[model samples]
Target chain A: MQLPFSLQPLFDFLGQFTDGPANALIIVIALIKIALIVGGLLQIIPFIILFERKIISWVQDRPGPNRAGPWGLLHGILDGVKLFFKEEITPKGVDKPLYLLAPGLTVAPAFLALCLVPVGPIIQGAHLDALVSFLRLDPSIIGPGGIISEIPLAITNPNIGILYVLAVTSIGVYGITLAGWSSNNKWSLLGGIRASAQMVSYEITLSLSIIGVVLLAGSLNLYNIIDSQAGGFWHWNVMAQPVAFLLFIIAMFAETNRLPFDLAEAEPELTGGFHTEYSSMRFALFFLGEYINMVIVSAMCVTLFLGGYHGLFPLPWEAIATWITNISPSFAGFYPWVIMASYLIGPMVIVPAKVGFFIFLFIFARATLPRLRYDQLMDLGWKRLLPIGLINLVITSGIIAIDLMVTGNGQVELATKWIIGAITLGLFLAWDLLYYSPRRKAQLEKDYRLYPKSAKKGEKPALAS
Target chain B: MLVDFLKGSALALKHMGNFIIGKGNVTLEYPEVKREQPAFFRGRHRLQRYRDGLERCVGCSLCAAVCPSEAIYLEAAENTDENQVSAGERYAEIYQIHLLRCIFCGFCEEACPENAIVMGASYELAMNKRTDFIAEKDDMLDPAEKGFGDYHEYDPYISHVTPESDKSAKGDPWAVKAEH
Candidate 1:
């Protein structure tokens, strides 16, 4: 009763009147779940677009889009609608067939990657006392002998989920590749080449960076990995393997081709990169794909480092599980429809809302940072992140070994070592912050002093006040 | 080396809380928190005048010509004996700096023949539309007597040694002027 119900009353009314409790619950859950994702995306996509504009403007010391909807969040909406209505102009000389197909290529793989994401607790696993069971088994993930018998909210609990993610991510390159190559434009070709090289280059490091996670989790399935973090913040990968988190975040940025890493379509040179010739819905799809990929990468980051769908505070997830299990007998007496409705909506609505917060973080980041150049991107992957990732892997292995030797348990439990982990993470972040601050200041000073007057050859001189 | 590295890292960790979340950011929010702009910071363009009340700009389109972004516009008019604004034969009548297009490169300041235009620290030029940004001569003209001149009231010749330099140079009777 203290649920402070938003959608609860509506489900209750539906159960009492037309449908049975069981069926009505399932229907309500299913409908709400779909609404949550679509609604969140519509809002998240637009605001992120506006936020990016605002951030970029401040970086270059200019005012960005702020005239559309409240604080110009509707600018992306305006863009989307305009792109949809505007002419889907297919240039005459281009390969019309592939050009049409290219945008979809960008979008589909992101959705595929999202399919494996565990947004919330699969209730069966959380509450072991279960009358109702929802267990999905894929041999590819859990292995041949291993069988996880549980009830969950995920669409499909694939065993080999991590591998599936890596494979699907690699597939996203095809969309950009097709868009660039099929366009028959020179800029498009250049964009495709750059994207292929960058995406391919980063994919190697990205996969390698997450190897530490796989080693630690000992399972590819995201559910098991999430469950491992059930112990709390200290158990979170962010603390234990900070270097891996760093590499993973950077790689994901490159993988998604966002700012600083977005040389593929830096606008002035590439003129919108691979999808330059695209127009109308096709163009919109590519745009949507970019944002979706951004969300997916952020989601993946949360999945690996932040506890995926697990709340920071412990009050609610346990309470919800108790409430769900108690209502089971009442569902049995009621009609099928009521019980079914509850089954679907409970997870669907709850899941997306949780996922939306991480998505917001991604948008926040895009709003705040600048894009990197191609060479700098290479240097980071090869020199910095890769080496650090390796060093971290070695150090973590040593820690795990020492823990096993002392306690006779291979597991490095956070309850005992959280302070140490926190200190280690705190120290590293501080050093980086202090070390980079001076260098960054000096480099920026050099750039400013040597720009415009002394070196106006390649640089677009800053316009006079 | 290992122990030293650990110690250095631990020191960083100890003070980390004071940095990212606390107030250790090097970046000053411009026009809001207001960074201390350099004295020669070339920002918004403003018109100039000589000490003797004659306009410093000699109807020269050098700023407009040398502008990389082509941001400045100047229309020179001849200074007649009756209606002379400047010491030179000609004076700028319709001078405009399109703030929207201005790149802040200081080229307009650099290319000035008479040193009539110099980059100032007036960085607060944010506007809503393109039209609002087109700063006219009236906005840029130095308010000499109203005490808003480029090197206003204060004696320019005085270094840090002269504590009383903030006072007006009214003793030099030629420096007296009306507001622009």
Candidate 2:
């Protein structure tokens, strides 16, 4: 086994201090990486909350939060301060330890799951080129350079990245369950039970949906998955496995307890559900956890389906680097930053922008769709999405098998993708139409009856208020 | 059925897209942009004056008689040589409208024989004290001079509705003749 790429430099620097093992240096580097990722996430969550509000308001045609500061950007900050100072209240009878532990449990998994998701590309080769060409640093001074080549804008890359995310997210249910159960309130208990059941049911569909992507990428590591989709928009999993994309999006919404599938915290029914007994910072943690989870899920969707860090157009990095170098003698040193930015920071911006679109969709869907009844939610997860997901997995695996057996050429693979994508789209459209036909007809007739234009003179329309 | 669902979603998407692109917002920023009140809007009452600066009220007590809320109070006095207040023999020595009891029904405006008590557009009648609700003669009376600092821009919609009314109120005989 080799030392991870990011820890090699640390080990090299610490080598002179003592003739000691590199394990301590590696651990420190790991700790620092973890701190950076967590700090960035904590800073980002409030803005995401603010963005959700702003998008929701814009969709509904109102200027939202422009009063707090420029475009109401500081409203979230003000809100966080307000939540912090609010009186912390624990109701008459509650299980003390579990109630306290629940919010932390909910928050921890979300933060941990973000570790494996790469936000930017590894820029080792280019950085090496830049170092050799621009900086004129001694090659030997940057020790073990070839060994520590992978430079990713993420905390760490585990071999089982996808599995880790699924496993960690599953554990998040316990937090909700404990929060509801420990509250000693019937509503909270009901919310907990609903959340646990819903999450469990959706987890199957969620895992099964990703089976298609995994099969296509042939890797569980998120960085590898994104690397596999680096060519163009067409190479994204969304095109290759359209069925899986649809299933993942639906299941992701259910997993996160977003609206339409948000049975657990259905404000009308559960009165804030599991977190009803929480107050101040505890309540704030749960809220923060929810938004961070949203960011993580959005990032995952971008990584999996939209081709994470892949530019929409093929990036001409060498040209951009040359342009920067020609700008002036002073900018020669900055060419490396420019080159790294084109490949690394460019995607850093693109990935977030794509994730933001999904976030907007989440908010838009909340505004557009009504909540599903409890039975409908269960039936959709168990009966509809599960079967559909299983069928999609089988189809995807079948395609992969065929590709391996027949002419294993790139052209054949492209043709296969197009064929499978078309078939899946047709099937989905047919299923959706058949499922919603009766309701559509009923809705139309209901509308006609309510506002009948052919009402006789002196006769009133139904017009029930 | 699938087509229907798609259609519904498309319609919603179109509406939202229009709004995002800066369309369909009819919301007025209330504090900044006030709405144009209608000509018939009976807000706080005001006593009118001729352009030549003569009070229109004859102190006939018609508005006091017709006020359903009993919000009006007046005291009649003989017009003196040095302080001739009205265009008639008698003038209101003390006229007050207790806005607290006033129903804003415009009956008082309709009952004024001299067309003196017309409701102006100043609807911000809030007061810190109970006594402040009572508008004395000074508060109700129109400005003595035209283009007074206290005057507001009149609504074009109201002016369009009653073009002759403004001219006659301003004592513009030429405009009244042109209208006739």
Candidate No. with top lDDT: 2
Question: Can you tell me which runs of candidate 2 are displaced by over 4 Å?
Answer: A1-54, A62-65, A71-74, A81-105, A123-149, A173-193, A265-284, A313-339, A402-419, A434-465, B20-22, B42-119, B123-141, B146-180
lDDT of 1 at A256: 83
Shift in Å, residue B158, candidate 1: 37
Residue lDDT tens for model 2, A77-146: 8889999999999887899999889999999998888787787776566565454334342344332363
Encode model 1's per-residue lDDT on A1-465: one tens digit a residue: 112334434545776874544456555545554465545565667667776665445433445566677667779889878887898888878777777777887888887776666666664432322222222222221222223344355545688888998898888888888888888899988888888888987887787767767766768998887777765566677766676676787788788877657777778889999889888899888878888887777777888877676655434433455466668875443332334444444345534554465555454445444566677777777776666666666666666666667887655567433533454466667756775676775675566464444546777787432
How accurately is candidate 1 docked according to DockQ? 0.03
Measured against the true structure, the TM-scores of the candidates, in listed sequence, are: 0.57, 0.74
Evaluate model 1: give its TM-score: 0.57
Interface RMSD, all candidates in order, equals 11.5, 2.4
Clash statistics: count for each candidate: 35, 1
- Evaluate all candidate structures by whole-model CA lDDT and list the values in order: 0.65, 0.76
Per-residue lDDT of candidate 1, residues B1-180 (tens digit): 224435654544444334434444345544457654434345667676655566767778989999988988899999998997876789999888888788889887767766677665566788888798888887887654422233223333211111233222334323212222
Q: Candidate 1: where is the Cα deviation over 4 Å?
A: A1-43, A54-73, A125-151, A316-370, A405-410, A415-465, B1-180
Candidate 2: true interface contacts recovered = 0.47
TM-score winner among the candidates? 2
